[model samples]
Target: MICSHVTVPVMIHLKLHELPAKHVLKRWTRDARDIIPPEYLRYQKDHGPLKYSSR
Candidate 1:
């Protein structure tokens, strides 16, 4: 007898036209928090607003 593991790819669907900016931002923050450390949160927060600014 042999044991085998199978992997499946899951597809996610999103309709951006129906989503609000605040909703998107909330999701982004949640995802980012999982990958970023507490000490870096302040730097990350600043970058979000400055991203659009040339200076």
Candidate 2:
């Protein structure tokens, strides 16, 4: 998972490595799950990068 790669415990708890809350937060957060497929990335390499807001 993305959390495992980060230096700090961003997504999950440090001790248990679980979600801190049961429900989504009401406020908008920059922290979000982003998964880009290899095919699309390769295409972008030859072509230009896509103007995507988020994944």
Candidate 3:
């Protein structure tokens, strides 16, 4: 008996116009959480914002 490897191509259909507003908001919020460290965000949240000194 002989065995062969088979590769399959995937086809995807996306209709952006058909998507709802809530789905966009859900995806945006999910992506936003990982942009920065939680501790840095906590410091900003508690102490207003970071002050940068330019040299």
Candidate 4:
């Protein structure tokens, strides 16, 4: 997805398959808003913010 923010560069070659692992791993090292897809975020709205958790 494209990052409009000045700090983060636009991700041009992103893949959909990559998302599942990131979600399972709960990638704390990266920015959630930047990495995760908007559609997934919208679908998961009931689950609260996509933050890393022990549980």
Best of the candidates, TM-score: 1
**Least lDDT summed over 10 consecutive residues: which range in candidate 3?**
2-11
The RMSD (Cα, Å) of candidate 3 is: 12.0
Point to the candidate with the largest lDDT.
4
lDDT of 1 by residue, 1-55 (tens): 1112311111113323343444345436556566776666667654554334567
Q: On a 0 to 1 TM-score scale, where does candidate 2 land against the true structure?
A: 0.17
Name model 1 segments beyond 4 Å from true.
1-33, 46-55
- The candidate, 1 or 4, that scores higher on TM-score is 1
Q: In candidate 3, which residue ranges exceed 4 Å CA deviation?
A: 1-43
> How well does candidate 4 score on lDDT at residue 2?
26
How badly does each model clash, as a count of residue pairs?
Answer: 0, 0, 0, 0
List per-prediction Cα lDDT, in the order shown: 0.44, 0.47, 0.44, 0.48
Off by over 4 Å in 2: 1-36, 39-44
Any residue pairs clashing in model 1, and if so which?
A: none
Clashing pairs in 4: none
When summed lDDT is taken over every stretch of 10 residues in candidate 4, the lowest stretch is 6-15
Sort order, lDDT high to low: 4, 2, 1, 3
lDDT of 3 by residue, 1-55 (tens): 1111311111113323333454345335646555756656755444566666898
